[model samples]
Target: MSDTSALPRPLLEPPAPQPNPGASGPWTGLRTFATAPFRARAWKEFAYLIIVFVLGCLATAYLFVMVGGSLYLSVLVIGVPVLAAVILGGRVWGRIYRVLGTVLLNAELPEPPPFTFRPGPIGWLRSAFTDRTSWRALLFLLLEAALGMVVGYLVLMVVALTALVTVSPVLWAWKDPHNVDARGVSHHSMVQFGDYYIETWPRVLAFAAIGVLGCFLLPWLFRGVCFLHRVLAAWLLTPTRRDRALTELRESRRAAVDDATATLRRLERDLHDGTQARLVGIAMALGRAEERIATGGDAEELIAQARTSSKEALTELRELVRGIHPPALDLGLGPALETLAARCAIPVELRVLLPVRPSPAIEAIAYFSVAELLTNVVKHAAANRIWVAVLPTGSDALAVSVRDNGQGGALQPADASGEAVVAGGLSGLAQRARGVDGSLFVDSPVGGPTVVTLVLPLAGPQ
Candidate 1:
């Protein structure tokens, strides 16, 4: 005995007609097939093939002359320079192909970093001689020259034949005033069968239909050729792995230098404003005390004032040093995190599970990153309890997870305090982690839990 209410129910009215998903249904497929010849992508690819074919021919001639002439002139004194020029020209041709790919095929290829040659002809020639990218580009041009000529000529001939045949019905009668073939059969068209020429209107119409079908398939042929060209471009035009690594290394070095500069500036500002000002007051107070003693007046009050100012200055100075390199980090990351957990306003459940100690630099980054996370939680999370855990992610990595039960959102959110997020006097703990080739991940949603994790290499940035 089953419940009918829970079993099933059917609608009283038929469902509305849904739009076809472009790949379903005979009608939709037929419509796409009919209209594919006129689509923008098909036309663009065809235009690209035509342009490539023309450029390929010109490039073929230029490369043949320059390469052959340079080789033939190798025994002469000017051969080296001529060869260098040809190599540089290959790079220029590479740029042209990249541009054409962008305009016609809507592909954006990555460009290699520019060469930095020394100030001399020898240096310029040396750069061209050792350039991997230029050599590859030259090879790409050669392949394009050969294949482009073949594909272009073939597609062009097919196009011409189809165009002529498609309009055969309209011009068949005008081809001859009598509308007859050489057989003198009246109403005959130019087409010939096995034993007899086509001599009827229906046969002429059928020939035109075949031409129309060919026109329909021409776009697909164009697409196939362009697809091959795309593969070739991607393989040769983009930077090699070494080039990409060099680029990333340059960027990371710049970021690290910028971070260090900002840190120094901040420390200078803090010393001038807080510790330096306090020390200056201490000096003034001691001077006043000396003058009072010389005049046989009371000096104890001024002396006490100077003592207070000196203590405050010493404390501020100590804090600035700790900000640079925390004393607790010298012991280990575990002890440093424990000290942070003790200082946080919220109750924290802390855990450390590492079998081996990491380098001092990595420990410092992990320490500072955790400290920053705890600070954000106290300032904005409005939470009652927090959790901190330090552990090894793998043989090569150390990971720290700081989580809080609070009103959750990403650690960084776009809001009215955009300057606070992007300006000076704000913390860049995330950037510090990245300086060591580390990563930070944040998992915070709008509710009651937010977790931020920092992963650093155990050995240091590679």
Candidate 2:
């Protein structure tokens, strides 16, 4: 097999699907329906509608009873708890709907944080009363009680009507009506619509034909209402902006915690393996010096040997600590990369355009990433020049790109199956970037040039 591992992954996500270029006219509505059967997404959304509409009706009933009972009991001042319970119940519904959206609709909504308050029932009740998520959910419940149930009911009824009317001839043949027409004659095998009765073959077939067309159009109708459900659920069921920021803070804190843990783990390993061994050797040399002095022999050589080994070991440990946050990053990421370029074996063109300094953590990540990428290019690129640049990516991120005009068969550390290899070029760099919620993109096409970019956040968790 050929080495197909260097294929470029997407630089960024592509734009959303748009209407087909040639779709312009009467059948545009049904055009999408043709592909509905083959699309798993379409079916999932349609099934979601069928399931949620049932749940919506049940929720609508629950809200009605709770609200009506609360209003009636407010006279006794007991409705306070009732109303609070209602709001809390809405929060529960919010959880359920969010789950359904995630499992069924693939919603990327993050779970909201747990409510925080002082202990005791009074505090809990007070918090519930002031809870923003609960209030939004309660409003959503009220809306679902009125508009939501009605819309679902209407759509389901139309769907059933289409299916039933397609068998209208069967209905007409199976039924007998007790109503007497203007001639005082009993009507049999006929269905009434306002003032008209379908007692003949022509009317039956005409309605059946309309039903058939509706069957083809049902997917669109189902999808439209499902889209509305998704919109409303996303708005009410998902966390608020404050909730999102809190979630991000928690996540960033988690990433920081994990990074610290890894650093400590590495430090422990180094102390146990390398530092400990070196210290033992130094201690042995010092003991030799002590013996030589006691024997009236020259001890200077042994003492000097111990001293040099001790200094080297101490330097190694210091470097390990300094590696945690590079000292060069204190001058900012741009200048750090400039220093890196100066040290590279290949001639380089460097561009730095950072309006504001990023958080120290970000600067450290960018500096080391460029440094490693530069080393990789020098090792494998076989090229004359490397181009490195730092540019602001929107308001929140900084992008650092390294392009090499080399023999461009640089593969990101991936195996033949495209699974990431842990110990290869670009793989380690990719993992290093991801530790800070950053990403690495490689565009190496095997002939001339390779462009690798790193997108780093400007600020820490906010």
Candidate 3:
């Protein structure tokens, strides 16, 4: 049986219509070709194609010279360093191609795993020889060079031909003897089609119209070629799916262990410094009061001290309990978040719209994720306003977002080893979220708004 009891009332209302980019009307193709040459996207892609073309040529030339010479000299021991250099160069170039493809082609390729080298020249040689990634990169460089030369030449010819034909009326020199007949009268050859000579002025105008049409079609055609190049790059540049999955699993396990350790240490410190210390003070006060009473000396002051110590201890214990699980959560996630917003250092606009209650474990994770994000904003982001929202991402997951309008340059930068530097408190929060199979994303550029989002499965920590 299916459960519908938890569904929200808002689900009954119709959702607003969203425009589908892929859905096309009768004039869609016409409109695309008409606007292709003028759109910024087309220009950006053209620029990207140009860059790929240039880099491909350079990579091919360099690798052919260096790698070929090294292979030829392999009998000599000196060739070892040269071979290592080729492999190293290929790896670096592969990374550059990956970055470019990501930005230009919008291809989301998983990063190749980091290479580990042992001590000494022999180790370096062995690693270089065994590195499949570097060799694949070298192969890609060779392929890209051939592909780029052909595609680049074709694109250049198309553009140049289009420009010449389109501007023939303005730029064609009729006074030149070659353009004129033996009679020395005005004459020029027009671009030809099959069985058609566009030699007359009227035909030349028609040829210009054809050129205009070609200009519009070329950009879209180039885009198709670029997509094919992206496919080739993905196959050659990224690690295999199995390898990527293993890497992610290892990282997740490490993060889970680290997060648990940090949490336990924090709890222990809080207990030792706050509640435990207060309890010890209370015990000493009570002991002193008992001594005063038994000795028949002034006991009033000692008794009063005991009462004060007890109150302080009780306060510390309440605070400690709250740290473990906020008391506000007893009322449910929405109300708890509202209570949290009320205590924020900066003004927070909170919104929560969930169709059903998430599992308690998921709820706890969501709560702490929000709390940590808000704390980060208060500490690092000098902001005047914050907005926190919790809503269902789908039937299976909920998304919580905390956004602040502050100076935003808060990101976990990658180290030299290409791993994200996870030493900061914010990185710890991300790891904690990851422990539950939830994901955290931070989008904070310099000088402004920072938005952090955490998404958790509705079924809880899976």
User: Among these predicted structures, which one has the highest TM-score?
Assistant: 1
lDDT of 3 by residue, 1-462 (tens): 111223321211222356897777889988877888998767767777788788877877788788888887787989878878788777888898888878877788767888877789789888888888888888888888877767876886787898787887655446322244445654456444544545666877777888888888888877887887788889998997766766767787898787678778987998898878877887887888789889988878867877887888788778778877888888789998998899899999988889998887788888887887788788878999999988887799987888889987665344576443222655666666666677676666566576677778888665
Rank by lDDT, highest first. Answer: 1, 3, 2
lDDT of 1 by residue, 175-210 (tens): 753445456666545766655655578888888999
Provide the lowest-lDDT 10-residue window in model 1.
4-13
lDDT of 3: 0.75
lDDT accuracy of residue 133 in candidate 2: 83
lDDT of each: 0.78, 0.74, 0.75
Q: Candidate 1 vs candidate 2: which has greater lDDT?
A: 1
Name the better of 1 and 3 by TM-score: 1
Arrange candidates by TM-score, descending: 1, 2, 3
